[model samples]
Target: MFQPDIEIIAHTPNPEKVCTAAVKQTYKKMHAKELIKNTSEEEVEKLLTNIAKLGHFSTLEHACFTIAFKDVSVLFEQFLIEHRLASYSAKSRRYVDFSEAGFVIPDYFEDKPEMEEKYRKCMLYLFNSYKNLLELGIAKEDARFVLPYSFKSSIIATMNLRELIHFLYNSIYGHGKEFSEIRKVGGMLLNKMKKLCPTVLRYFDILEHKGNASILASTYESSKSEGVELLWHTPSPDKSIAIAALIKSTNLPTALLKDIKQEEMERIIQSVVRSRRPRELEQVNFTFRINNVTLAILTHITRHRIHSPLIPSLASIEKSSSYVIPKGIKENKEALKIYREAFDRCMEFYRYLKSKNVPKDILAYALQSGNFITIITTMNARELYHFFRLRTCLRAQKEVRNIANNMLYLVRNVAPLTFKNAGPSCYFYGYCTEGKMKCNRFKEVVEHYKAWHLSPTKIPGL
Candidate 1:
């Protein structure tokens, strides 16, 4: 039978009543008396059911469900974690030794003995290579570059009832219906949530997809490309909108935004911004679609949960052609030879496994960490400020640093005043924070972003 090892680890007690009480508080004005005392269970159920029918689900956010996943592939974790506004604690690959770890075998390989053997054999070989790299004095972070996505992993994901319903409705009954594994897990999680808050959970529309596989295949086709491409999906048209929003917050007429020149506007924007006053920048926004980046870089940027990332399955993007050879690796002829050889062997087995009709989910085990992926996300100016400061630091990974630098350059062009202060934390605070790990190039980092702010068009090589 098709089943995934998932359990409801913890959930809010009397979740329906809690949600109903929270919903009631929002509708009525605060009268100092106790609001939730002596409410009947039947009354709570009726109230929540009525709210559900009326399509009011904001109160559902007050209820949360935490679930534990076991014996699942790392690929699944990537997909599940894309549901932002959720808390996740997954076992770390960089720190955890997966040498002796077991993997989840998909039922797709059950009827085919040859493909199943190839999968098991490939996993054993990959794990041995991974362990050998570790034995060769390579760091776990580097050695993990050889690990496959199908490697079994564990994660505890907790989400509010509102997001949980959205995840279920989207993954199980909506766009994700074509993805069998996500559909299966989504169905199981949905059933679990209904048990905790039946009244609130009852209103979700869990309809299955009628689309063909071409719809899903097209996503994978777009996932792999040869170079970095950044497109501003929803850049603000002018500085006026941002200025108007901030002025509105101050209860001032938006017409004032028109009265101020660019120079005065920059001062007004800058005056409100401080290390502690970042929340004021939330009035501005930027959305981007970045293509052809390695999963290593994707892993780092996706940590900024304030934004929503729509990603395709890692299984589809796993290909030898999609692997990125680090610049350092490419500099050494022997190292480059060895790296290419390893990827060739990995893909050779992968292609053979695919030819045998092995499921793509299982085949993802043969993919290297350098595999390519595309990510589309949106972050408000506040989160972008945080992202730039953290990811643009000298201590951060180079690939994402390039990405962060490019993002800052693009945003500055759209709203120069709003993002005038965006850059590394050291640039903003006037001192390096990395201590001994610092690149000791504080002046250089500051000048680099200074050029970005000063430039009229896109900075070359960004």
Candidate 2:
């Protein structure tokens, strides 16, 4: 019987083991000989289970894994998206031509013939309705906007040792199979981790024990409190502070600016860029002009600061993005228009901004890296305001949370670096930061999150 939700495709060596190896290697400074060298797998596993004090973590990035997901519930899909550092490419709802559709039939429904028939009818009707919406010229996004999250989705996610540790810990220690029939799935993956990466996998086992202890303790407390159930929840809503949209447009195109230079097109554009006789700046007199440069100017400022490290190092630097897209060698009208508009505007803006008596601080923010044209964004590791204000909120977007998750993994890999014991407040404290604290899985959350940062295979502490 097919389950319509939640399945694991693949994971790397046990996360903790990778981490243990990484941490150990960073300090050891030797090529990673298998931590289980000269030892049997059973012996290695036992050692990992007992001797977890070797807190080194330097070579974790060397080991990574990619997991393929399919037939996931909205809850599970959302849960995975919270891990940002993992590379993902999901089937786009916008472009997928689902003229014909498919749906998974659960075991329970399959067992009940009548229910199965009803479910099948509903799926057909929903699919037809979606097709009809498209036929009516509704944008794919708007048409899909109403679709249920229960619909199937497939995503390929790439994870390094650090992230896998985080994902494994959370899934094994924190999550419950919402449908009650998928617990064995976790065991299957856990078994795999236990073999290939004993050191990291051992951490999962320890967390499992810790989780059980918590359950028992909670049960005892509940028993004393006359049969109260210990329920978990998300944190309270933040007060609506209307922070202005602080979007710093960088030297990036709104869309991925493709290099569409054909032999002739390249000759023309390059000629335009390096003209022997440059055109004089003649300001066209138009009072009604919006001076669209306000936002563009600000974005360039921030973008330049981010890419500065790719050229030179910043002490406050944590990490930078690799968002560059080299232009394509094709010709299209829109592409040509964009090339002309972007290059022209950028040149004009440069001259205009320079002519003005702009302040040094704002001017410093403008322009971009001389090379590497991707839309680079930088995060200052020491910037407490960024994390404290953003990561703790339940209302934060999922993509940002995933980014935060990646940041947490990277921080832990570098030990006592900017992100030590990193994560949402749950990792550092016994409770959620929100005043109401709706998600009661604080202990569970911390245990799950710690696996990524404290894997046995990676270096112990870097």
TM-score of each: 0.83, 0.40
Report the lDDT of model 2 for residue 133: 57
Best of the candidates, TM-score: 1
Cα lDDT of all candidates, in order?
Answer: 0.70, 0.39
Model 1 agreement with the true structure over 146-203: per-residue lDDT tens digits: 6676677788989988888877877765655555667778888878777877766666
Off by over 4 Å in 2: 3-23, 26-47, 51-62, 73-75, 181-188, 198-203, 208-462
Q: List the lowest-lDDT window of 10 residues for candidate 1.
A: 206-215
